[model samples]
Target chain A: SQTIHQWPATLVQPVGSPLSLECTVEGTSNPNLYWYRQAAGRGLQLLFYSVGIGQISSEVPQNLSASRPQDRQFILSSKKLLLSDSGFYLCAWISGGNTEAFFGQGTRLTVV
Target chain B: AQSVSQHNHHVILSEAASLELGCNYSYGGTVNLFWYVQYPGQHLQLLLKYFSGDPLVKGIKGFEAEFIKSKFSFNLRKPSVQWSDTAEYFCAVELYGGSQGNLIFGKGTKLSVKP
Candidate 1:
């Protein structure tokens, strides 16, 4: 069975502070990873997706960026956070040629 | 660019009430459809999915959705919803054979079933 782990389940940081949210998958290799944000009534929005290491495709332009350092490790980062950057961030992974995606317990970031 | 639209932003229903949540997409070609449920304080769970064949797909917890090609719709339905069914529901779409495999989602519909 595959499992995804997201760190610092909840965080409270002052505005303009640097941010780092990490996600990792176990029991799978070369899996496609994705980052999504869930806001109040806005649903889940795709932020970034990676097919392989060092390959990231951003879905929307925002104050965030993503990186795939390893085959199953994905990190979402922000140099300077904005008030609008506060939301529940989720990490998901799908095996190559697979349709269903598995999600991790999200990180609730509050930019105070 | 592809997108998904869920008709209701919120819905309130009493137990045993028949439930139907409308979902539509803005694409003309082949696509995969999905419905996810997120309970309070929990991660998203796959309620159902539509890949190919059998436009009507059944999912966990007695939930089902019908795919209408002509209308470009995939509406989730339940004969009698339980109070435990209260949760946020999301409709998502992925382009068939899309290289990037980006899954687009709609602004979810929050369902509140009262006992």
Candidate 2:
């Protein structure tokens, strides 16, 4: 069975601080990885998605950037996070088209 | 741009009560539908999906959803809900409009099942 892991289950950062959230998937190869942010009482917003190593597609224009350093490792980064960037960040992977995705525990980032 | 819409923002029900959550999407061409659940303080988990098959699809925890192509709707249903079912339900649509990497989601419907 495949498992997805996300670190720093909860985080609190001040505005203008840097941010880094990591996501790794085990037991799968060449999987599609995605980063999403869920605001308070709002639907998820796709921040970035990676198809392969060194390949990333950003959805929203924000302070966040995503990178696929390895086939199984994805990283979300922010040089300067804004207060609006505070939300629940989730990482997910899909086997392929029409396949359901598996999500990690998610990182609750609260930017003060 | 593709988008999804979940009709009910919140719903309250009791144990053994029926469940039905509406999910609609805006995208032409072939599409895929999905229903995900999130327990309190937990991450989102896939409950059911509709790709290419019978419209009615069954998922974990006795949850089910039906897809109506003409209506562009995939509604989730459960004959009996439980207290453990108290969670937020999300309707996600995989962009199948002849595109790659879909999974657009709706605002979500928060279901509160009482004991």
All models, DockQ values?
A: 0.79, 0.67
Query: Looking at model 2 chain A, which ten-residue stretch has the lowest summed lDDT?
Result: A93-102
Per-residue error for B115 in candidate 2, Å, reads 1.1
- Candidate 2 runs further than 4 Å off: B97-99
Per-residue lDDT of A1-37 in model 1, one digit per residue for the tens? 8999988899999999999999999998998999999
> Candidate 1's error at A53, in angstroms?
0.4
User: CA shift at B28, candidate 1, in angstroms?
Assistant: 1.1
The true-versus-predicted C-alpha distance at residue B76 of model 2, in Å, is 0.7
| TM-score between model 2 and native | 0.95
**Lowest summed lDDT window (length 10), candidate 2 chain B:** B94-103
Tell how far residue B25 is off in model 2, in angstroms: 0.4
Please give, for residues A8-33, the per-residue lDDT of candidate 2 as tens digits: 89999999999999999999899999
Candidate 1 accuracy as TM-score: 0.98
Deviation in Å, model 1, residue A31 alpha carbon: 0.5
